[model samples]
Target: MVKWVLALVGYFIYRFPGAIAGYLIGTLIDSSFESNKKSGRKGFDTVFTTSRSQNVSPSDFELNLLSLASIVIKADGSVSQTELDYVRAYFVQAYGKERANATFKTFNDVIKNREVSAQRICTYLNSRTRYEVRLQILHFLFGIAQADGRVSSPEVSQLSSIAGFMRINQNDFKSIKAMFVKDANNAYKILEIDKTATDAEVKKAFRTMAKKYHPDKLQHMDEAYQKGARDKFQKVQEAYETIQKERGF
Candidate 1:
């Protein structure tokens, strides 16, 4: 990201060769900074967040997320304290404790009483965020649904609706859903491959899924967001290993 920004500046200021030099410099800086961060010498960007929604304020993002969580918690006809606590804890970890508390307060006072419109919210979100980020949000909602240890039928229906509204394709929705709602040892389903897939095809699917779910892609968000991503990434790895063990290859 730094490289791209600097390379663009260099292109304007000094042409093609300067762009190359800028990129080389930016690479070193990015790498050194990443190393410092990993070693705990550097800290999180004090900026809590800005959504891809450039026009809307960032607090809208937090409010919408809490609204979605509320919808999921109430989907099963009764709210579970466990699910509510799970959402709070996740926010506390992903954002900060103060921000999470304020967001939840706003949800209760403003968004929670209104009819939750998944379609309207998703239409607003789909344009701003990348497909990958929406997928992560869907995964997070599923985490909420299953926080009490089981996803109810109503919750599943609500999740499916949200996924559709977010424009998540059927296959991607099924793949994530399989993780939260499992039956009959469905590793193949989780991988979005068939039991009869060729070994090469299975391997190919696993690689694609692994890359898609990699925590590095979400590293800019926050530690908790990356940790959530790792949950999905590990599931991909586990499915692959199960298949590999079964096939003995």
Candidate 2:
């Protein structure tokens, strides 16, 4: 409508060239306005969706962690008090006494019902969490499984299955398992290095493992989770020390 009006006015005032120029200018302005309106809607939708998704907070993370912990604890067809204590201490340390007491009931119910599936939880976590964070979670689960002094074959199989669902690499899963499974008895495996490697290669592997498993890398996590990472970091350091002592380095 506006373009036709502009063109007619232009034709009366200055004939063909003026009509062409006016119509072109009007069409350009109309197209640009429509494009901006569409972009505005898209921008708003993006912001709203992102904010909604990011609403998954640290407490939510802890809940999911506890839920998955329960599943892992029951993997061997038994649930030990030691494993439950490990999880309880985690919540108490991370969420404080009051919150832990409140959340424990839910954790207990989840365990009693046996309704949560490890694979489903792992799938959800994989979709939502970063790889580093998922690795840390796997480390935590291994710690819980070993809290009773040993990680059973069934528990190891369950951990491996969870890692697979989480899209964690097999080598990375084995690296974490080596830290806890003493039956392997190989510091080289703990450091994830070749037995025949030179001292320099061993030192390099230690540094790499140290950096990758550092607790500080998990500062964004809850304090309890950070403590779990610190424990793993110490284990890595211990493995390195053991290698150095045995090799007389």
Which regions of candidate 2 are displaced past 4 Å?
1-53
Instruction: Output the lDDT of residue 43, model 1.
Output: 28
Per-residue lDDT tens digits of candidate 2, residues 1-249?
Answer: 435644564565568986775576545434543564566522111211222374333334555677788878898998898999988887787656755654564346457554567777776566567677788789889989989999999999989988998898877887888888875455777778877889999999999989988888777656766887788788889888988888899
lDDT of each residue in 79-104, candidate 1, tens digit only = 78899889889888876676566555
Clashes by residue pair, model 1: none
Which residue pairs does candidate 2 place in steric collision? none
Instruction: Give the 10-residue window scoring lowest on summed lDDT in candidate 1.
Output: 41-50
TM-score, candidate 2, is 0.73
